[model samples]
Structures are given as C-alpha cells and as structure tokens.
Target: MLTGTVKWFNNPKGYGFIQAQEGTENQDVLIHYSVIEMDGFKTLKAGQTVSFDVGQGPKGLIATKVLPDNGQGAKVDNTEVLEKDSSLA
Candidate 1:
C-alpha cells in the first residue's frame, strides 16, 4: 500500500482524489467512497492521511482498498453532518 493525503472529497458525489506521497508516479489517484474500508462513516476528508493500493481503472489510475493511517475507524464530525444537512435544507 502507498501513503497519501486526501486532496479533496465530494461526499454527495461519492468520489475523491488522493495525492500520493513521494515515490509514486501516479500522484493524484481517484478514490471512490465505495472502496474505502471504514467501519461506520465510509467517507474521506481533505488533508486526511491514508494508505491505499493503486489500481488500473477503465479511465486511469485509481486508489483501492483505502484505509486511514491511524488504523482506527473513521469518525464523522457532527459539524460536518450539520453542514450537509443545512446544504440540503
């Protein structure tokens, strides 16, 4: 697995981009929310550190089997939830 930081994620769209750390040729890898292996909140946040495997998709490079570097389950912030709700309202 390679280490990287999430560049950005669109929760509603269910996709994101991960900027891989040094040593990987594919810097920006596409990551889908479905591939993220988190317990509760299967979502990614920008600036969050993560480890993942590179895979070839129909379009281009993509991040697969992603996990948080901290090894703990991802926690969904209440503020984020509220923001999402407010946006919808």
Candidate 2:
C-alpha cells in the first residue's frame, strides 16, 4: 500500500484528491468515498494521512482502497457524511 495525505475532500461530492508521499511518481491520486475502508462514514479530511492501493480509474489514478492512518486528522461527525449524500440528491 502507498502512504499519502489527503489534499481535500468534498463530502457532498463524495470524492477527493490525495497527495502521495514524497519520492512517489503518482503525486496526485483520486479518491472516491466508496474506496474508504470505514464502517460508518466513508470520507476523508484534508491533510489526513492514509494508506491505500493504486488502481486505474476511468479518468486517472485512483485509490482502490483507503485506510485512515491510526485515526489521525480532522474529526467529522457521522451525520455529516450521511447528510451530505442526501443533500446532493
């Protein structure tokens, strides 16, 4: 798995970009909410450290699976994730 930090994530959009760790060729990675390996809310925060695998997406490099690193980064309420999704529709 590759380690990286999230650049930013839009909860309502359910997608974000991750900046890969230094020395990696794929610096920018696309991450979707579905790839987040969490039980409740599938989302990531800006600057959050994460471990993920790389895969080819329809557009570009995408995170096949994302796991938050030791629960680090900003905290978000569970309702936020759910609320954002519903708001989009």
Kindly list the per-residue Cα lDDT of model 1 for residues 28-84, writing each as its tens digit.
Answer: 899988889867768878899999988888887798789977765356668977988
- Consecutive 10-residue window with the lowest summed lDDT within model 1: 68-77
Clashing pairs in 2: none
lDDT of 1 at 57: 87
Model 2: CA > 4 A from native: 22-26, 71-74, 78-89
Q: Supply the TM-score for candidate 2.
A: 0.76
- TM-score leader: 1
Give the local distance difference test score of model 2: 0.83
List RMSD in Å for every model shown.
Answer: 3.6, 5.0
Report every candidate's CA lDDT. Answer: 0.83, 0.83
